[model samples]
Every structure is written in C-alpha cells, then in structure tokens.
Target chain A: MSTTVTQDMSFLYLISSASVLVQLVMLILVLISFFSWWFIFRKLFVIRNEKRKTDDFEDIFWRGVDLNALHQRITSARYDSGSLERIFAAGFGEFNKHPAGSDLDAVMESTRRAMRATYQREMDYLESHLSFLATVGSVSPYIGLLGTVWGIMNSFRSLSSVTQATIAHVAPGIAEALIATAMGLFAAIPAVVAYNRYASSTDQLATRFESFMEELSNVLQRRAAG
Target chain B: MSVSALRNSSYSEPRILLAGALAVLVHLVFIAVLIFGLNWKDQQPEGMMVEIWTELPTPIQESVKTQSPPKQIKPAPEPVKPKPEPERPKPEPVKPEPAKPAPQQAAVTPPVKKPDITIQQKPDPIKEIKPDLERQKKQEQERLKELEKQKELEKKKELEKQKELEKQKELARQKELEKQKELQKQKELAAQQQREQAAKAQREAEAQRAAQQAAARNQITNEISKYKALIQAKIRSRIVMPPDLPGNPIAEFSITLLPGGDILEVRLSRSSGHAVFDNAVERAIHLSKPLPLPPDPALFNEFRNLNITVHYRE
Candidate 1:
C-alpha cells in the first residue's frame, strides 16, 4: 500500500498521467493562477504604496504646509510622487493658471475638473487588474470542473470495455481528476480573498481621493472668493 | 495630472520582473511544500489477517464418494445370490458314471469263482485236510464280501463329495453371472446420469447467455434512444421553422454521422409532403454542427446511421 501511494498518488504522477485535454486544462489553470498571483502581489505593493503616500500627503496638507512651496516641491519630484500628490498638483496648477482676478466660480470649476480627471486616472491605475483577479477567482473553478467532468467521462468511457470494474480500476482516474478541482480551489481561494481585499481598499482610496478633492476645492474656493 | 505622475502610475519593467520572479518563487515553494509535507508523515496501516493457500481446496472428493452406490449395491446382491441354490441337484447324474467300472470288477469275480471250484476238486484227493480246506474257503468268502462292501461305501462317499463340489461350483458361476449383470447395470446408470448432468448444464448455460444478450441489447437500445433524444433536441433548438399553413407535419431523415457526432450526410428519407418543411429540417440538421453523442465509442456504431422522425409541432 505504501508503495502504491508513493508510485500512483505522487503529484507529478497525477499531473502527468492525466489525459491530454485534462493536462491542457490543468496547464491553463496553473498559468491563470500564476498570473493572478502576480497581479495580486503587484496590486498589493501598488495599493500599499498608494495608501502610504496618501497618508504622507494628508499629514503634510493638514499640517498647514505653505501650498505654493508644497506644489513646487511636488512638481520638482513629480516623477516619484504618489497618486494623491498628483491630484493635488493638478488642482493647484489649474488654480494657478487662472489669475486671482479671474471669475472665482470659473477658476473653481476648472480646478475641480482638473482634480477630478487626475483622481479618475489614479483610481483607474489602482483598479486596473482587480477585474482580472475577479475573473480568475470566479471562472477558474468552473474551468477545473470542466477538466474534472471531462476526465471522469473519459474514465467511465474506458470502463465500457471492461466487464467487471472494481474500485481500484476507477479510483486513480477519479483521484487524478479531483486534483484539477483541488488546483482550481487552490488558485481561486487566494485570488478571491485578494480580490475582495484589494477591491475594498481601492474603493477606500477612491473615497479618500474624493474627500481630498472636495476638501482641496473648498480651500481653493475660499482663496478665490477672498 | 502631469505626464511624469502618469509615468509613475505605470509599473516599471524592473518591478514587473521582480513580481514575476517572486510569483514563480512563491509557486515553487508552494509546490515543494505540497510534495514534501505530505510525504513526511507516515500513515499507520490497519491490521488484517490473511490465509495463504498453495492449492485450491477440493470439495468434490466427498461428493464423488457419495455418488457411487455400487459399493452398497454389492452387499444388496449378496442376499439374492442364495436364490440360485435349487440348481444344486444338476451335478447328481455324474455320480453314476464312476459305478460303470463296477461291471469290469464283476467279470474278474467270475474268474475267481472258477479258481475256487478247482481248489474244491483238489480237496477230495486229500480227505484228511478236506475239513480244514472247507473252513479256509468259507473264511476267504467272508473276507471278500467285507472288502467289496467297504469298496462300495468308499465309492458312495467319493460320489457324494464330487456332487457337493459341483454344486458349490454351480453356485459360484450363478453368483458371478449376477455380479456381472449388476456391474453392467451400474455402468449404464452412471453413463445416463452423466449425460443428464451435461445436458442440464448446457441448457442452463444457453439460458444464461440468452438472458445476458437480451440485457446487453436493452442497454444498448436505451443508450441509443438517449443519444437520439439529445440529437433531436439539438436539431429542434436549431430549427428556424418556415411559417406556413402546415399543421403538424412529420419529417423523417436518414442521417449519417461521423464517429465524433459530426454530420456526414443528411438525406430526407421520408418528406413531410411539404418541401419547405423538409428543407427546413435538413437545414436544421446541418446547422446543429457536431451534435451531442454518447461518450462511449462502442455505442457510436448504433448511432452511425440513424433514421430520425421529427414532428413539427413543439
């Protein structure tokens, strides 16, 4: 029994002994899982970085740093600046483009538009591959199920030639087939958890960006009115 | 946003490479853990006792011993053997043949009487010894009579012994004949029983084979019907029926399908009498490319050439 388990139930044996179509399905699922994880890790880094930068910028802005000096410092290091910083710069730059003598309402409107566009772009970046993660999370299990069903069907079909089938005859095929579902769940669970986490965090970041936009627009509004 | 911040929004190539490398490393670690972790633990096996046999057990020995009734029948025939005892008297006539030699003994006795007469004539010459000779002749006659009587008694005893021996021989011959008949009857009975058993087994085998064939045929038909329903459903779903004044017209098609369930040839074997409906059915049959089939390849032969009749109602 020990020998049988070692020989037949090995991971490489199960994957290699699978039918060609089932092997293809497993390969596709593995590649999908790999890419999803890659995206997951990438999103993890990007979102964490964005959140840290947002925290830093919020601290500086609320500390009442001189708006012009902050803007100049951000423009100088624009290449390394975060998403919230970019939104702030866009708003500040647009505010500066219109003279203080211009109609206050028009200047405020243009600044808000500029900030909103920049905020949208940053949100787009944050939310880029969450959909891919979602697609992988939802569809990979079905893909695994497809492989399983096909594998079981093939196994049973082969049994047509056999007059008397025992459990030993069919067990290996089923075990190999079930490996696909196991892999599917393996791939899907992490993707789903990561997707949920990243999606909500991205939503929170968007909310923060929106609130910052609103808050910055009001500050600009007060200055323009004065 | 400024273009430089847009550039920051995009991931650098180095970061993508690092993420990809990390993903590969993580997956490798995960697979390695799966392989090694499962193998590290040893499972305890349940104990089971097994008996090993060098040869198959033969339960037939007792049955074989029981089937042979001839041993018991041998004892039964022993009592019947005594019934042939009345035939024991048949050897009694042979006892008289040994007494035919008594006539030759009588001829020899007449010659002894002539010698006795000569001895009497010589007795007159010797008057002094006449009385003694007469006494001696009388004693000799008596002794001869006793010897003759003893010979007759011995001959009778010998004839009785020969008769008894022949009677026993006759009984043994009768017993032997009866035993031969019994043995032949036993052989015939065993042959008949063996023939009966063989015929019965053959009949049973034929019945079982017929039943299995019937069951296999039923299963095949069931599978074929199931696949037929599937193909019909596919075609029905694909049918873009031409609207007209037709009631429920049935169209029959003789379809030839490849092993993979792809349509090879679709000929309208029996038209619905409406060319439009027939054409529509044919078009639907073709439209449903590679129709659903049973996964079993052995059942595909039954589905290779199908004559399906479609009613244009539902």
Candidate 2:
C-alpha cells in the first residue's frame, strides 16, 4: 500500500490527481508560464536583432557615408531597414523637405521631432508583450500559492471525516499541494529573469537611438547653418 | 497612425511563429524529461534510515567461551589419581602382614626353651626306674636314645612347618601382588574411561551452552529489531512534521527507556537544523509513550538505550 502511495507521488500523478480548484490553478500557472516564455523568446530575438541593426547603422553612419546615398539606400529597403535607419531616414527626409535657406533651428526642431516619433514607435515595438512577462513574474507564484492553500484546506477538511488521522491520510494531499508552489517558483524565476534582461536591453537600444538622433540633428543643423 | 503602420510593417509573422513553436517544443521537452527523470528516480533504491543494534559487546560471552577448554582438561587426571591412591594403601597392608608373620614365628620358637623341655622329660623317666638300678641303667640309656631321636624328629617337623608357612606366604604375596596389578590395570582403564566420559560430557555441555548463548544472542537481536521498528513506527506516526522541510533531513535521538517500556529520557543527538522539524520529532517522541519493549527481561538491556534516527521522508 505504501509502495503504491510512494509510486503515485510523481509530478504527473500529483498534477493529474489534484482537486479541481488546484488543477485549475495549475492550469492558469502553466498557461501563464507558457505565454511568458513565448514572450521571453520573442523579446530575446527582437532585442538581439535591434542591437545588431543599430550597430550596423551606427558603424556605416559614423564612417562618413554620404547622407543622400545612405538615406536613399535605407528608403529603398524601408521594410527591411532597422529602427535606427528608419529614424535616420525620417530625420533626413524632414531635413530635405525645407529649402536650402530655411531657418536652421526650425528645420533642426522638425527633424528632431520626426526622429523622436519614429524612435517612440521602434521602442514600442521592441517592448511589446513585456508587461505580460512582468505580470507572470509577479503573479504566478501567488496563484500557485493559492492553489496550495486550497489543496491543504481541502485535505484538512477531509480529515474531519475520518476517525484516525495518520500522516498517510494527509501526506498525499499536502504533497500534491506543494507541487503548485514548486510550479509557481519554476514559472516565476525565469519570467522575472527574462523581463529584467529584456527591459535593460531595450533601454540600451533606446539610448543608442536617442544619441544617434541628437548627433544627426546637430549635423543637419550645421549643414543648414553652413 | 503612420508610426503604427510602420511598426506593423516591420513585424515579421514567421519569426513569432518560430519563437512560439520553439517555446512549445522546449516545454514539451521539459515535460518529457521530467517524466523520464521521475520514472528513473522511481527505480532508485530507498536508503535505510534506521540502524539497529544487533551485536552487543559482552565480556561474559568471551569468558564463557574461554573457560570451557581448561575445565575439559583439568578433571581428566584428577579423579584418576585419588582412586589409585586408596587402592595403593590396600596393597600396603597385605605386604606388611606377610613380613610380620615370619618375624612372629621366629620369636615364638626359642632354642633355650626347648633344652628345658628335654631336662624335664629325663627326670620323669629316672623316678620310675629307682628299684631296678641295673635294668634302669640300660633302660635309661635306651630312653636317652629315644629322647634324642624324638628331639631330632621334632626339630625336623618344626623346620618343615616353617618352610611350608614361608612357601604359603610367598604364594599369598604373589597372588596378592597379581590381584593388585590386575586391580590397578582395571582401575586405570576405568579412570581412562571415566576421563573420556567426563571429557565427552564436558564437551557436550560446553557445546550446549555455546548453542544456547548463540540462540540467546539471536533472540536478543531479533527482539531489538522488532521493538526498534515498533518504536520508530509509532514515533513516526505521531510526528507532525512541519510542512516545507527542505531535503530529507534526519533527526537523530538517543532515547533512554525503563524496563516497563516507559521513556526515561530523550535527547536529540543530532539536529536536522530545522527547529520546527526537530520540535515536531521531539514532540512525537514525547507523545509516543510506553514504547513496545521486548518481554524477556534479559533482552531489556538491548532495548535500554536506543539510538533512533527519523528521516524527513521515511
């Protein structure tokens, strides 16, 4: 009998045999964990791609590539271009829309505005679904805890129906309940770690974009002044 | 609106699908690995948490074992010597009797006393012959000759009697010596048989005692395990382990028990470092009063002080 009980203590058995509420809670945690991981991976790809694109654009731009040629190349491949390139194209297009003798400060301001708007959209694209990761990181543990508490309560309540209460009587219930907490920890740890890593990387990319925009604005203002 | 349009165009649907597929694959792999790992773990042999005291160091057992050999050797020659000693005294009396009888015969027959007896006989014959002096003188000569002849015959008869007595005594001495020799041989054989019998009896008794001791030790060990299991099971049942105890921490306790199975003392020899677990174990030990002890009083020593470990899992 004990052998059977010990054998049935596997995670699959425990999860499968859990009470309805606990099962529901575990389901919620699993869904949260799955989606959180999905977002984590997607964000990982997005941030890495964005960082590489920014590095490419910065290298080419700094090596004194002709603004017109660079702008033309970026605009031709607009759909395939990175966020930094789009921001540069937006700023350069806004600069060329003014006459050669236009007010330098007004042209520079409008150029900065276009770059800022594009920068905002690119940052939004990079950080999408990150809130879901943050929510999973913060909330899944509590949901798992709730499942555990409900499981323990159910087990103890069932104890009232029995005359003798051995650890055997209550141990399986408690063991099954503990799996919820374990699942919560399992889901929360990775989500929290991924969220932190992706958030910092996105922030780094935003800084790079802002610096590039500032440098471009200065260069365009100098050309207008010249 | 333009920024939203541009962001929508920048998004690649294939990449999202790829990431999602990878995520599902990763989760499925994790579940499969978990299932496989747990199944593998199920095959693992559970560790033994309870250690029972089967062999006790007993000085008396060693003494009993060492004392059997000398006892077998000591009595072999002891009874043989005393029995032969009493028999030797019996032969000594028989030897002295033959020697004493020869000296008594020599002292009884005196040659001076024999001369007096001859003088008396001569006087008696002279009184009767007073009237006939001449005839008496001839008769006296004849009587003297007869007396001399009778004395010589009597001396010869006494010598023959002495020779016969000496021969009889020598024969008796020879017979007695032979009897004593036969008796001694019989006694020596009896002693040897007795010694062999005694040795066999001693060996059997020693073997029986050894067998009994071994049986007793086995019984003690069996009873110890029986009661140890009982006490541990009872305590384990009574234990209300604190939830969330990390790992399988073992709490060791040395329990002192009375003869009647009542707990005298319980000291935590090794703490599991979880106070709640330690306290729960301690409480359980206290709650399980009057543990099941072996009925035999001799086996009580084995159950007197027990060292028990309560593993968190077990």
Candidate 3:
C-alpha cells in the first residue's frame, strides 16, 4: 500500500522543549570531552619529557660525577622538567644552606621538607583537570537517556492524531531521537578511557616521586654525617 | 649601705612611694567626680530649663511687681475719697435747712468744708467721675455700632438664600438629564441582546446541517467496503501462481484501488522470501486493471482510494 506519512511539527516542538535539559547536559559533556582530550595530549607530552629527563639525570647522578659540578650544569642548562630533578635540586639547595658539619638530624630534616614540598607541587600539576573527565564518564549516559525519553514522549503524543498506526508513521521520529543517545555514548566512551588511563599514569608518577624522595633523603643524611 | 647599695636604696623607696600615692589620688578624684556628677544630673529638670530662665530680663520682672502693687493701692484710696465727697455735699444742703432751725449748727458744719478741701487735694472723686462718664459714653457708642453690624449681616444672609435657591434649581435640571441618558443606554443594551440571540440560533441550525452531512458520508463508506470485497475476491482468482515459489512461502500484499477498482499502488508488507514469488504477486496486481465499479456515485467516491490486503501462497 501507498503509506501516507505525516509529521506534526507540534511533536518536534514538544521534543525540543523537553530536550533543553538534555542539550545543556550534552553541551557540558562535549566541553568536558574536548578538555579531557586536551589534557590527555598535554600530559602525554609532559610525562614523556619528564621520563626522558629523569632517565638522563639518574644516569649522570650514578656515574660518579661531582654533585656540585652537576648542580652547576643543571643551573646553567635549566632544561630538566622532571619531578626527580626538582626534588633533587630542592634537597641539595637546603643541604648546602647549612654550615659544614652541622647536626645531621637538622640537615636531613630540612632536605626531607624540601623534597616533600616539591613532590606536592608536581602531583598537584599532574592531577589538575582530571576530576572533570571523571564526572563526564559517570554522568553522560544518563544525560543521553534524558534526551531519548523526551523524544519518545513526543512520538507517543503524535500517535493520538493517527487513525491507523504503522512503522512508517513512527520510524523517522524515533531515529532522530536516538541520535542524541548515540552522541552521549560517543562523548562518554573516550572520557572513560582517558580517565582510567591517566589515573594509572598519575599514580605511577606519584609512587616514583615518593620513592625518589626517600632515596634522596638517605643520600643527604649520609653526606651530612660524613 | 655601701656606695652602690646607698644609691639603689635612695632611688627605689621614694619612687615606689610617689607612684603609689599618685595612683591613689587619681582613683579618688575619679570616684568623686562620678558620684557627685550623677547626683547633680538627677536633680536637674527633664530637658534644658536653663534656656527658658535665661530669656527673661530683670526689668520685666520689676515692672510686673510695681504694676500689681499700685493697682491694689489705687482702689483703696478711691473708696476713702468718696466718703469725704458725700459729707461735703451734705453740709452744704444742711446749712440752708438749719438756718431756719439753728444758726449755731450751721456754723459747726463749716468744719466739714475743711474735710472737703482734703478730699479735693486727693483729686480721686474728680478722676472717678471722669472715668465713669467716659466709660458710659463709650459703651453706648459700642451698642449702636453692634446694632448696625446685625442689620448688615441680615442683608448678607438674604443674598446667600437667593443664591442657594438658584443652585438648587440648576442641580435638579442636571439630575433630570442624567436620568434620561441612563434610560436610553438601557434601551440600546436590550436591543443588542435580542440581535445576538437571533444570530446564535442561526449558527446552531447551520452546524446541525453539517453534522448530518458527515453522518451520511460515513454510511456511504460502509456500503463501498461491502461491494469492494466481492470485486477483490473475483480479481484474486484470475491471478496465476508462480511455479518457482520457495518452500511453502506465505505473505500478504496490500494495494490501493482507484474509483473503478483499478489498482494504483502495490507493496508487500510480509515478504514471501522468494524473489520470483514476490514478483509474481506484483505482476498479478498490474494485470488486473479496472476490474469492477460501484453503482452509486457516493459509493464510487468512497472507494476512490482504497487499501486491500491479499494472502498469497494458499
């Protein structure tokens, strides 16, 4: 049969009005998605550089180079952006501030405080803007469902005017409404993936910072006692 | 004490005593000022009465006292003078009468004339007579002026009464005109309501006729469906079954029929699964052209566009 399909614009109007909240939520999701990608890429670059610098510094430090000479090289170059390098510099600077043969306990206390402060600063920077990604991952599906509910309500309301209902009468409206749900999933999947990945990377970096602090503290303690 | 001990001892005791005494003196002064000031403030009047007392001068106070005492003494002196004036007049009149009786009595009354001279020196009787006569003439003039004012007021009241009567007549005329306008407005409103009633009745009759037409149209639709079913069955028999049908395929096809029962459009809602079998169903619909027509024009119009579902494959 030649199926006569008619759409009431009033249905669209109802759907659009109900979808305002969904649209607002989707807008926020999209913004969060964009910012998450941005942070992921930026942190990827920063962490990669930090890893390289840390590896180089560890190599140089264990090679029996004089620490004062290494300090001069680090000061002049200023190229190292690693957390370990900053921790090392803070601890050593505090160690050099005291007179020679001062109390070993006092020297170690100052160096530990300096390294803890630097570690806190680096962790804060790495963890910034991560919460928004988490919120997007958790809430996006519900936001998309809100849009789908609004669209289905409009479809059912228009069915009242129809004398004999058929698939042709309902399909297009349902299809258009489902697009929002699909978009929500689209925005949410990447956010969730990025959050899990970045969180693990940040945890690894934090563990490294803590272990480095302990090792550097032991080194400064020995230097003070000697 | 040694020299250092002597110096320290000399400085310390006097300094401590002087500081202690100064502190005590300061506390005593503070306590005295607080107690006495509070007592004096409580004795003072509610607001500032000092302003009112400062406004009066000594000369005004003195004038009030002097004026009150003089007024009290002047009334007493005037009564004494009246007594002397009456004695003097009695002696003068009594001398004439006694000359006929006793000349010696008339000579004794001459001493009463000296008393009259004492009264005249006081000048109180002459001042009292002048004031009394002046007061009586002033009261008579005041009474005459009051009578003239009463006559003028009566004339003004007559003019006011005439104006009030004119205003009352004008107000009555205005009230008559307002009543006439209100009556006219009521008449117009009643006419408008009658016109509206007539129009509303006409609209009701028109709507009833349209509803009757719609009912007739529905009856015609029922009759056309009855006849179209017979024609559809007749056309179904002429359709040949295709031999290459797949495995007992069963489906239905619907077609829109025109006014003369000619198939307009055809589609299969349920597919027979075999492409050749489905194509045969479509060709059958095309081959059966203008199979039958309805007898009545209204019934024919009702079947102008029709939907039919046909079951294929037995």
Candidate 4:
C-alpha cells in the first residue's frame, strides 16, 4: 500500500490552493462581472423608457396639433417630454424668439441649430454607460484569460517542486484556473448580447429623431414663407 | 463637471449598487444550485469488486499414473456467488489432505521371485538326462547277466537301483528348500527398501506442505493490509472535517463489507464526542462506498467484519 497523503480537493480547496497572482486575477474578474451585470440591468430600464417615451411623444407630434399650443403644453410638462418632444420644443421656442417679418432663412437656421443641440444632448444620454457595457463585454473575457494563464503557470511552477508528478498533482490547479475563464464568459456574454440589442434600438430611435428634425424644419420653413 | 455629475440620474451609485446586489444574488443562486447539484451526484457510491482465490499449494506428487502434473495446481473454478450470507465455512488448509504417494510396491515384487524359479530349473534338466543314460547302460548289462546267471542276482541289483533313486529325490528336495529361503530373504529386502523410500517421501511432502501453508498465510495478511490502506486513502480524500474543533478527535467504526467491497453496514463503535465531527467522518465513508477489498475470497474473511478508526485531526 502506497502512503500517498492526499488533501481533500474541492472547489474550496481549489480557491485556497491558488497562487497569489492568480487569486488576485480571480478577485478582479469577479468584481468586473458583478459590476457589469449591475450596469447591464440598469441600462435595460433606461433604454426601454427611452423607446416608450419616443413612441408616445411621436404619436402626439404626428396628430397635427397647432405647434404653438403643443409647445406650450409640453413646456409646462417639460420633464415628461421625450427626446422627440424636446427637439420640437427647442425648434419652436427658437422660432418664437425671432421677430415677426424677420429674414425667413435666418429664422429657420436658428431653429435648426436649437433642434440639433437638443438631439445631440438626448443621443448623449441614450449612449451613456453603453460604452461601459461594451467595455465589460469585450474586456472581461481577456481578464478571465489572464487569470487562467496565471493559474496554469502557477500550476506548472508547482510541478517543479514535485519529484514524482501525476495528473492529480496538477488537476486541481487547472480546474481552479479554468473557473476564472468561466466566470469571465458568464459576465461578458450577456453584456455583449444586451449591448448589441440596446445599441440597435437606440439607433432606430436616433433615426426617427433625425427624420422628425428634418420634417419639423421643413414645416417651420414653410410657415416662415407664408 | 461636478454639477453635471450630480445632475446625471443614470450614474447614481445607490441605484447601481442595488441593481448589482440583485444581479449578483441571482447569479450566485444559480451557481450554488449547480455546484451543490453536482456534489450530490459525486457522492453516490458506485464502486465495484470481484473476489479471487488462488489455487491451494500442491506437495509435488501425483498418485494417479495416467494424468500429467500440469493439472495438479490448477485452481477450481469459482462457485456461484454466495450473496447475503456474510459468513462461510472456512476451508482451513490445515485439514486432512488426500495422500499423494505414487504406488511403487506392485512394480518391485516380481523380480525378487523370478531368480528362485530359474535356479531350480538349471539342475533339473541335467539330473533327468544323466539318469536316463545310466539306466540304459544298466539295462544292457542286466540282459547279458540274465543269460549267464540266475534270477536272484538280478533281483539284488534292482533293489540297489531303487535305493539310489530315492536318494536323488531327497537331494532335489533339499535344493528346492534352499532356493525358497533365498527368495524369501530377497523379498524382505525389497519390502524394507520400499518402506524407507515411502517414509522419506512422506517427510518431504509434509515439509513442503507446511512451508506452503505459511506462505499462503503471509500472502493473505499482506493482501489485507494493502486493501485496508487503499480504502483509507479513498475515504480520507472524501472526508470534510468540521472547522475549529478542539483537540485531535478520533472516531472508530466497525464496518461490515460484502465480498464485492460494498459496505453492508458502518457502525460508529466509538464517537469523537463532537457530533458534527463524527458525522463528517461517517459521511466521508458513505461517499467512499464499495470500499477497496481483497480480491481473494479466502482473504475476504479478514475484511468481512473490520474495525476502522478514523482520526479527525490527523
């Protein structure tokens, strides 16, 4: 009977046996995953509300209500106005600032400038922390890979101390190292998928906002000529 | 930038942290379920074993004249599995052994008697031919004398010839008795030698058998300890010790094992006094089911009921 004194190796054992560098890598990956998931869920609500707000504001905008009356009503409930409604407000507000019988081209240009500014600000808000999701999606896998490589390296380094090496000697090391990669992918995959979905939906909203800006600019231009 | 940062609703730390805690809770629950589920599967005991018994030793003599010696030590094929019964009548090798001496007495007797018959026949042909020649000569002489002399002379000669014939019969009887005595001595010598050889062979066979029995016993102990160590190794790996226990607590168990290494029962013969500590050790053994066992059924008797003491600290 060979007296091979094997210590109990479980998931806990794997973590306990990990080298310092690899352990740090695992800790970092865990935090990254945790934070990424937080942003992912938070962004889910933000994007959904943006879409609903855009849709609701567009329905009223297309009802052909008087511009002055629509602007006044929305200005009173300005906090509730979506990107589309805000854009409309900015354009009409700038148009009212122009004196009656002013140069029509200059008036339309001023209105266009105000509408463009609101569109940029709204797009910035829509796109904020989206980069954070993208960063998490693309970087977490690499962080996990870094942990795996370090763990395996430490595992190999342990082999140098072992005079007689068997698979059991290094199996725990490799398994522990691979867990880092698994966690990384767990954090990255959903982030990547959500980022793709949200980015596309935001682009759809952006396209609609741009088209509304053009339509509103054309209406104001005609009103100026009349 | 500070005023704007305060203005950004999306970057609120409290809201993000609450979201993170919820997300982490979901993921942690999912992982815990998977890991614990996998653990239950691993804990199942599916180990297997088959008992083996080597051939009993042969003392190196075959009594049967026709068969070769190769078959002498071939082990008997294993009988049906005697399941459920934990005990069997042990076939202790020390019992009465079938005699194994080859019969040499029948081959030795004939040559001892043949010489006596050959010696008696050598003088018989010569004695018969000489008498016949002598009688022919005497008969010719008597014929001539009968013409020349009276009948009384011939009668006297006849009595003398009869007496000489009686003497010759007495001599042959004495010779036959001598030859019989010589054959008897030779038979006795052959029998004595046969007895000596048989005694020597018996002594050798007995010595060889004693040596074989000793060897078999040694092999059995070595095998038992080897398996004991193997089982301990497997069980030790499965053990999950309770943390922060005081002293080096030791627990002892009396385990009943089947021939195939399946643990029939494990009784806590002595507890470590710490219930959780004792429980962990028991669970370890349960997980290490179908413990490693000796392959020989003969050896299984040693392990059939065994006492194992597992030390918690060590």
By TM-score, how accurate is candidate 4?
0.48
DockQ of each candidate, alpha-carbon based: 0.16, 0.21, 0.02, 0.12
RMSD of each: 19.6, 19.2, 37.0, 24.3
Q: Write the per-residue lDDT of candidate 2 for residues A56-163, one digit (tens) a residue.
A: 999999999899999888776757778898888888988898988877778888889988988988888888888888888898899999999999998898888776
Clashing pairs in 2: none
Best by TM-score: 2
Pairs in steric clash, model 1: none
**Recovered native contacts in candidate 4, as a fraction?**
0.20
Worst 10 residues of 2 chain A by lDDT: A1-10
lDDT tens readout by residue for model 3, A59-174: 88878788887766655444433566666776777778889877888878877887787677667766766776777777777777777777677666777678688665565456
TM-score of chain B of 2: 0.63
Worst 10 residues of 1 chain B by lDDT: B43-52
Error of 3 at A117 (Å): 0.8
* Native contacts recovered, each model: 0.25, 0.33, 0.00, 0.20
Report lDDT per candidate: 0.76, 0.80, 0.60, 0.69
The C-alpha local distance difference test score for the whole of candidate 4 amounts to 0.69
Overall local distance difference test of candidate 1: 0.76
Off by over 4 Å in 4: A1-7, B1-18, B37-314
Better of 3 and 4 by lDDT: 4
Model 2 alpha-carbon drift over 4 Å, by segment: A1-7, B1-5, B40-314
